[model samples]
Target: MLWTTTETNETLAAQLSDELRVSAVMGQLLAQRDLPTVEAAEEFLRPRLAQLDNPFALKNLRAAVTRIEQAIEGKESVVVFGDYDVDGVTSTVQLVSMLRTLGLEPRFCVPLRLDEGYGLSHDAIDRIFDGDVPELFIALDCGTNAHEPIAYLRELGCDVIVVDHHQTKTEAPKGCIFVNPHVNDPEDAPWRDLCTAGLVFKLLHGLLKSRREAEDPRVEGIQLKDYLDLVAMGTIADLVPLHRENRILSWFGLRHLRANGRIGVRALAEVSGIDASQEMASSDISFKLAPRINASGRLADATLPINLLLSDDLEQCKGIAQELDAMNRERQGIERGIAAEAERRAADEFADEPGIVLFGEDWHPGVVGIVASRVSRRFHKPCVILGADGDETHGSGRSVATVNLVEVFQRCTDLLGHWGGHPMAAGVSLPTANVKAFTARYLESLKALYPAGLPEPSLRLSTWLEVEDLEEGLLDELDRLHPFGQGNAEPSFGVRGVVLEEAPHAFGEGNFRFRMPAVNGSRTGVAGIAWRMHGVPEVGQPIDIAVRFSWNYWRNSRYPQVTLIDWKPSGEN
Candidate 1:
């Protein structure tokens, strides 16, 4: 969709430059986020971890901490139960490491994606109870909405502390202590957008603070910043918003990650061939690190990633990293095949529907969510991809940014046997008989919620750039907005009336290439790639383009480049 900014808004942005006494570029960027006052502007520019709320702000914080402290004092066997994803693995690592430092016996456990299914399950809990680990289970990133299994655990006298960030239903599990932001007060802290790792980090902060107050200097030098790398890895991998506390955590975590990297991180980097000297970005974590970690759960046991993260041995870490890398390749093969099949089915089946819901009896539950996400993005609709096994059917949902999917599930609570997640992403399980009913109800609820036209996608441009401003200095100035992600995105500028002086270089025999343009009496090069646009651009045609200044850094190579977002040939001027 074509987008044009308001002249009044542009004037206000210009006025902000004068008020803040900063460059117009920076002022306009802040103005885009709707920063009204200078105080808010300062806070936005410099997010302090100290400015973050106390960890005790969560409900039942004292109860949860007291349980952990009792376990530490008694030397009771504690098991840190986690999920397969980055957020889950990191939470396990963070909590396990902290518990060990506090003189507690903590072992980690994770359910396999294919074999055991998602979150806290009755079978896994039963097995743990059999192991007889003093009935202490601290679940991270899971177990928030696990009503049945949690109640079963309670019957077994097992205590569960659920540290999660997923939205909860009104009828939640009767947990030992549920520390979720969505519960209690909504206005407690804006950091509720944090991933599971962020929630676990807050809990650890409380534990550490208590230990330090009791004259434990051993906890003094233990900087939680050391684990910011894991926090950054998990937060970015899970695709959490890089805003507020998440932004602060990631910004600082990325810096430390580059400097004092972990063995598993270094090994994964070596396998992926990423240099530590170069700064790590969110894309690196999402594409490279996260995939390898998640591959463990897809093809093998989820314990592999947990082992890799918590291991202190270098050789073992390298072995696990290489194993995960191998699994990632296998996972890619499966994901591609499944995604292709899923797309075909989606196209054939849901051609008329505004929302998509597809189920296959033979589909693997391990990778359904990722496939669903791909299909959802391709179709630009909310999707629920289901995989059936025996009488139980599991599904994952990915929604467009406009819809509140969790709310839809809340409305269709009767059809869903179990459901929990954020607004845009969710996981569900139900009997095979209920798939059609749930899908129909879900679509109906969505239609009722947003009867109006869906909002058109817009490219938020930071500035309107003329050909004259395509200088090395201007690109350098743009680099000030570092550590970009959801809240803080890479700055995009519009270059209007620019002629494509030459045919684009179609690189790698794929859907991307660079364009050579002649503007302002000079030959200025810009990188242009049609991600899905295979048709060639007409030579010598003037087009309105959205572009971002980017740097391609590799071994012994560094250069400025522009990533083309969208371009349409223009008749104006």
Candidate 2:
């Protein structure tokens, strides 16, 4: 793989370091992120709640608040329909909880992934509404382009409010208070990329502010901060860029998550083996918490996690957490079998193709997205993994950094039934008989887009650091840039002239553990681990290595750990 380094502005870095009293490395990182002025860097480092823009600034938010107020005043029958993912579950819980506090016990439901498919579907609406139609219908995390379902609700004499973040396809739904920033707000708005949970948080903030202005006693003690845990989960899980208001929400949200104030989260964390007493990082949410929450949606009804989050009972939450964990384990086993098969198929069939399109007759539809992601990364090409869903093949597509799945899908729209998502990831469904045509069209489109062939895979180093610079001070400085995600990625440094203390200890499959010689006259060496390495580097020989530095919390103690990404003989770039 090719290794590249970001161009650094030394003058700006030095100026930031001097003015902000931060280490030179921190300043360099700030400059790399385009934080031009000291104020911008300072705000990025210390994101304050005061920095969040007014929720009322979002278009249609006031109308949504007014409609919700009418529901509260009349004690109208309310129903909140959400998707079957982390963002959707958390958004549903947050809005329903807040509405309950304001004197309305809202009925909440999430679409069953296997039965009703995704978003605001007529089948899902029918199942949720059954015989009783809600007076006020609120759709979270979906319904941006769900004109038919939104119209169906209107026909039932229901007022609709859709708080979504998905990009609109064709046109926006009519006759509803739609609050999607990507559609109605400015491109540079700080909250433009907020997920459904964050949007719901903003909605609640608006409702609370208006209620307080009206001297309502019920919302007096509603602490919005208490809901940040959910916001952080949704924001990080949904993979939105962590900048501006998103950074502020997630930065504080991780702290609130670590506090474990909510009984359900505390219980879920316990089952997930997360120590709530320590600093909660984005990886904890991405790898641990998010997967368990998503597992219920994939294998069963997503309402279980919503119920878990909203429940106040400790033992009940524990039972639900355990059930979700079991489902996740089941999901992992199913995913492993399918991924191994899909990888083999991609390598054998589409190794020379610009993209991969694989379909399995018996593959589980819910787990194909994860398999698509793994296959795409392993092959370094765009991939679409599909499973038999009735008469149609339905699944998801994952793209490499340089590819746009949405643009690619648009070229094949004639063969697709329904498809929509962001540039990097998307869901698609097409008739099973058309799968071959779609595959050919997908590959042809990719070739047309990139006539010179796809770009080679590469790893980018944030900046170079010396062995002496890998000290506690650097780690402390890195701490200020917590909760890294889509936009603000965790930095990986290129370190030169490193000699291992001893021969590395080989461990699990293609994995080994090594230690770097002591720096700054320290007694012990810095511990490091490398995964899936090609071969061990020579010991006692100076070499260049790319690594990510972080604290490894084990047995209730924290120690600096180095995660080796790549290494080569010194001077061999």
Candidate 3:
């Protein structure tokens, strides 16, 4: 059963004329989704980018900038070590671009998702040390909890600066310079949901500011706004909150995306077919750019996406973007196949278990997090998915709404080799032999917290309405809820007593579509489709639906597509 909140029109929604303006259906949609308050409704209706906070406000930012400035002055070899995901890749690009403009050859290294897992590894550090190692290592999007690796680097007489946003363990890593937002007292920082790139952007901004203070004209022509494109992509793709600082970044980032975007980004936009002229919403990047960029690490090598982003050649970028697009298609197929197998295996392994833990001998580590996330959503339980190699296993954890994955891992610390992450997601390394024990102990820990079954997730619909209130202006207002992600979600509303105009139409083989009418004089035709939604609801059935309004710009024409949330028969059947 779905848990739902009451719907009441906020004053803003109530302002619309009952007859000529937005219909009751539209008002209810707004209220149900909690977009009724003037401020919230304004945020949902219009996101202005001018309000983002300056990056200089972060603590220890001055110290980080001082160290980088010193390194640049002394011509010290600098290495930027970022993660393998979109956040890591973008952080690498953002920093490297800035450092290069200063005539310093800033070398970069990203660990292989399959080989090095996530974050700084002793193996990666060893490789860097064996080669022309940098005197200073700047770790972005990761390395806050890399106690062992950071210690090893310090032993080698290297200075390490961590600019990450992940939640840290109770005992922080020692010896390396840590600039995590989670550090110190919780009351100080205004926001905690900063993704990795956002942190790096601030550090870079501070460095530039320090240079300007020194009367260095070298900072000129370095457009920080140009880099917001990367920041916005990483922040949204990382699923951080899109309020306050994040909202400001993404708001302007969309403008940069529409104008003066890098060749690679432009190429990506081309194939994705997101018109630069139109207002690109957060949904556009989540469904389009993120998957394409992530497919590199998922199927083959992450270097492809990184190289594509760093490339200046339009033809080369276009080729690579198209290649990544194809690779993403292939990844979708692989994910589907592996997910089905993993589900079957989970069903057998977790028959009576309170939590889920599963591993495959040759499972692709690159895809384990994706699999784990899928399982967690599917089972409504905390899940840990592992990929084995000889005696050691590398894995990623994704928790449900009620679970604290980092704390769970902290309790099982004795069995883990290297571990770190946030409340919702974590990564760990354990002996293959310890997997069963860890799973059992973790399950027991969960029992202590939640003795009963997990509660049904509440779908916080923004508003409620009837079928007759659809209009173009209301759809326009929906664009304001952008950068919709982890903290602030896209508005979803429900409509009741909607009569299906025909049997849900089946297209794209199994993709389902539906048609319905409007209350206006004109017969307002609409179709809603769910992938593989064919043969679900019978034709002419009266059903209640939860939906988000969207504009699908296809073939030079724009029309509404209601992203189906949930639909059930309206009457007691």
Candidate 4:
């Protein structure tokens, strides 16, 4: 893999360091984000809830609040519909929990991935309704382009409000309250990139403020901060940019998550082996917690996790958490099988193509997305993995940084059934007979978009550092930039001339663990681990290494840990 170092402005970095009283590395990272003023740097370093924009400023939020207020006053039946994902599950839980506090028992449901597919679909609607239509319907994390479903709800005398953050494929749905930032708000708005969970938090905030002003007794004791744990779970799991409002919410949310105040999340943490006693990081949500929450949705009814989050009973939550955990393990087994087969097919058939489109008659639709992500990263190409869903092939597309899956899908819309998502990830459905034609069209569209072919993949090091600089102090400074994902990425540094004190301990499947010499004459060396490496660097020889530094917590101890991204002989480009 190629290694590239990020360029930094020395004068600006120094100025930021002086003004913010941060380490030079912190200053350089902040400067690289193009923060124009000291205030901006300060705000980034310490995100405060007070800095969040007024929730009412969001488009259609006031209207949404008004309709919800009417529902509460009229004592009307209401339903909360969400997609079968972590963002959707958390959004549903937050909204439903808030509504319960406001003296309403709203019924909530999520579409089964296999039975009803994604978004607000007719099948899911029929299943949720079941001859009992609510007076109000609110869709979360989905329903941006669900015109037919929204219209159906309208026909049933149900008022609709869509709190979604997905990119709009067409004009907004008519005759409903739509609260999508990408559609109605300015591009530069801080809240523009907020996921549905963040948006729901804003909506609930607006509702709480309005109710408190009206002297509602029930909502007086309700603290919005109590919901940040769910918001963080959704915001981080949704893979939205952790900037602006997202940063503020996740920053505090991770803390709330560590507190483990909620019985449901506490139970989940216990099952997922998360050390709630330690500081919770975004990885806990992304890898450990989110996958468990998503596993139920992937393999079974997502309502299981929804119930898990909403249940106040500890034993009940434990049962659900264990069920979800078992489902996640089952999901992992299924995903591994599909990913192996998909990777082999991509290498065998589409080795020379600019992108990969593979379909398997036996692939589980629930795990195709995970397989697509793995295959795409391994080959460094845009990949679409499809599975048979009756006569139609339904699956997901995972793209590289350079390719926009949405645009490529738009070119092949004539052969598609239903498709819409972000640039890097998307979902699609087409007839089984059209797989060959769709594959050809997909590749053609990619080639047309990039005639010169995609750029070679490379590991980008945020900065170069001396081996001696790898210490707890630098790691402490890096903590200011916690909960890294999407836009606010964790920084990787290049350390040149690092001689290992001893041979790396080889482990599972081409993996190894090594130790760096103690910094500043400390007795203990920094621990490092590398996975699936082709070869190990020689001990007692200077080598260049790219790594991300962080605290590795185990049992009850915390120590500096280095995750090696890549390594080469000293001075090798």
Candidate 5:
């Protein structure tokens, strides 16, 4: 596979190393990440809650907080309407928890994905209200583009606060206290890239600050740090960039996750076979925890996970966690079956095109997004996977770095109904009649933009490392940047010229494994595993490899190992 390596400035790295009294490799890694100045590097290395920007920086934060405060103080009813995804569920949990701390019982509703779709629907509001509508409604992770809903809420004498991160129109929701950052220039906004959970944390921060300033003793003992566990789950699950407060939240939240403070999260870890008692990382949340929480929303009602998150009873938490675990298993089976067929069809259907769009009547709508992402990554091109029901079709697309799925979908809006998302991923709906036309337009856009066809994938290398550097000590030094994801990816190092200790061989999974001597001249030779790899070379094959250095960990034990990204014959560099 092709790769791109970042050039290192030896002189600058040396300067940083001498000043910081760290390894040159650590200095270079920090430099490559653009934390050049001493203060910047220091802050990046040691993110503190004190360093978080003022919560009032979020647009409309004060207004939202004041409205909530009034509702609580007056004993008025409140409702939390949120999306069905992990972000929505977590944000709902966060906000509801804070409201309870303020001494108000808040009613919260999560839409059934199959029935209500995304955002605040009139019917959903009606269901949540029963007869007497809440005095105030807070919409989490959705409702920014909900003009009609906002209007309907006003008619019903309800105030609305939209805490969302999705893109919104210039006009904004009329009279609704809009809190999204997308309406303004995020280039200078500290809170722009935060996911809804992060936004909720900021809102809580503002409320706590105002309440404490006025000498409110009730808000005194609330640590706020205890809630970081939920915030971290949502941040990592939602794929928000791990920068600024997100990094701090996730970094500490990971600690909270490992401590397993929340009964629900602890039960989830146990049911999912994750030893959460040990230190947890971002991948654990992404792979183990997020999927279980998301499965509730995808395959069934999202309220299950939210209830689990809110519950304090161990028995109830365990039961919900098991149910979600089962749902996740069901979701996986469905996703695997769909992905297999989708890949086969793509191999034939999109053999020559720069992109692909496919739909099936029997496909599960909830799992199509995952398959779309998988198809896009597999083919390394933009892909749209649709689930058809009667005459209407809803589809989601995942884009490569070369193409913006949201932008492309917008250009082809003439063929779509409701559509919106970020640059890398998007959702769309239209009549099944226009599916073919939409597919054609989508391919046309891709062909025009990437006329040369899909470009070869590039494995980005952060730095080159000798096998000797794969020591337990280096892991500690590199871990100054923890909870790696999105904007802050775990560094992938290039290791040149190592002879295989034995013939490479495939395991039960597609991963290839072998051992080689530790170039650091240590007594013990280090081992490596290359996932999703095929075609093994003979013993003593001199090879240069790209690897991510980390601990090969088990219960109460850890040893150094390199996870290979790619490899070539020796001397290729």
Candidate 6:
């Protein structure tokens, strides 16, 4: 599909380019993202640790820190309960590791994604409370909406500190210190969109500051920056917006990871085929590192990755990393088969519907979210993929930015047993009998929201650049905007009037790599590759393409090139 490029202010771009000594294209890209001044551009292009906001600014930090300090000083045990995914596991490890510096060994537990389910569940709590009742329990990446579970923990004779980043209900869990940004009504807070590990970092920072204020010597050697490796992995894997505070964390975190000191992180990179010497990006975390960490949680216990992250033994970390790698490969195989089946079902029957909801009698609950994401992207609609077991069904849904899945679920709450998550991604469970009603009501809600018509998916083009322009060191210039993800997307440029040198040579069944011939008055010969692109342009055809300029590494060096995002015949634009 051809993209609709938003008009950018040439005046602003030119001013920034002249002031900051950046290329015109980089200036335009920065302007489009709302960076108007030199200071904003500098902050974004080169984020420094000093740019991070004070930890005390986050709401409830003082109270949460005091509570944690009281528990530690009194020698009371604390249990760290976290969610099963990367964010959750990393959060657990971060808090536990920090607590150990204070002469306290904290017990922790993560709910099984396929069994005990998500976030402060009764089974996980029972498992944690089995041996001894802790003085305080900390819930990470969860417990924001877990009122009953929090109440139950209170009954178990311990106060719970809820350190999370998920959406909350009208009222937070009673009597718990709600450190979540959503519950705190944080206004214009740069760290409002923090992931669980990020929140844990804040919590630890607050604790460290409190201890330092009292002249506690134990806090001396605890460097919070040392933990950014885990923070970067969780931040990128959690898919939170990588701007503002998060950009700083991830930017520094990647640098720390490249230092290769931690056994688990280094082993994970090695087992996942990441070179130790190469400068890694956020994409490395998203595509290479995180999946291996998340694979253990998806298929088995999340504690496996947490153990790997916390392990100091080189051989132990390597063993765990290899096991995680094997599990990730297995996960890929299952995901591909399930995605193919779900896509076929959506194409066959869910085409006319606004939301696609599918359930299998024996689907693995672990992979449902990935399937929903694929289905939603393919059909350009909200998708809810469910797993049915006897009378109950568990599911996950992914949606476009325009549609609010949380609101959609609230309207259909009468039929759902429980549901919670952000606008773009959510989870739900209900009686198996209500699947039909859910399908109908979900589509109806989407229809009401978009009465005009369901909008087609369109890519956002950053700026227009001719094929010849890509050869001019733009990729290295783009490095200033490192660690692109949710908010900070890698720039996409439109290239026009490029002729293919020959019929693209197909390397795989669904992809091709070939050369583009020069245009009149241009020296733009370059290699191009398109994956799963339909209507493959024939030899000698003039094409206008939407592409992203990126580095393609070979022989231990990075080379600049353009990756095709979308394309059309030259006149289509």
- Local distance difference test scores for all models: 0.77, 0.91, 0.76, 0.91, 0.84, 0.85
Give the TM-score comparing model 5 with the true structure, all chains together: 0.95
Clashing pairs in 1: none
lDDT of 2 by residue, 7-114 (tens): 889999999999999988998999999899999999998889999999999999999999999999999999999888999999999999999999899999998777
- Superior by lDDT: candidate 5 or candidate 6: 6
Q: lDDT tens string, model 3, 387-427?
A: 89788899889988767898788789888877777788888
Mind sharing the TM-score for model 3?
Answer: 0.91
Candidate 1 clash figure, as a count: 0
Query: Tens digit of lDDT per residue, candidate 5, span 57-83?
Result: 877899998998898789889999888
- When summed lDDT is taken over every stretch of 10 residues in candidate 5, the lowest stretch is 516-525
Better of 1 and 3 by TM-score: 1
The list of candidate 3 runs beyond 4 A from truth reads 6-50, 185-188, 273-279, 507-510, 532-535
Q: What is the lDDT of residue 27 in candidate 6?
A: 85
lDDT over C-alpha atoms for residue 377 of model 4? 92
Error of 2 at 373 (Å): 1.4
Q: In angstroms, how far off is 322's CA in candidate 6?
A: 0.7
| True-vs-predicted CA distance for residue 124, candidate 1, Å | 1.7
Models sorted by TM-score, best on top: 4, 2, 6, 5, 1, 3
* Best-fitting candidate, scored by TM-score: 4
Predicted candidate 4 versus true structure: per-residue lDDT over 1-573, tens digit per residue: 888878888888999999888888888998887787788988888889999999999999999999999999998999999888999999999999988887889999998888777788888888899999899999999998889988989898889999999888779989899999999999999899999999999999999989988998888689899999999999999899998899999999999999999999999999999876788999999999999999998899999999999999999999999999999999999998988888888999999999999999989999888899999999999999999988988899999988999889999999988777889999888889999999999999999999999999999989998877888899999898898998889999998889898899999987999998777878868899999887999988899999999999998889899999888998777
* TM per candidate: 0.92, 0.97, 0.91, 0.98, 0.95, 0.97
Residue 363's lDDT within candidate 1 is: 80
lDDT of 1 by residue, 215-311 (tens): 7766878988788888888788777777778888887787767774678788877787677567667777877888888888876787887878778
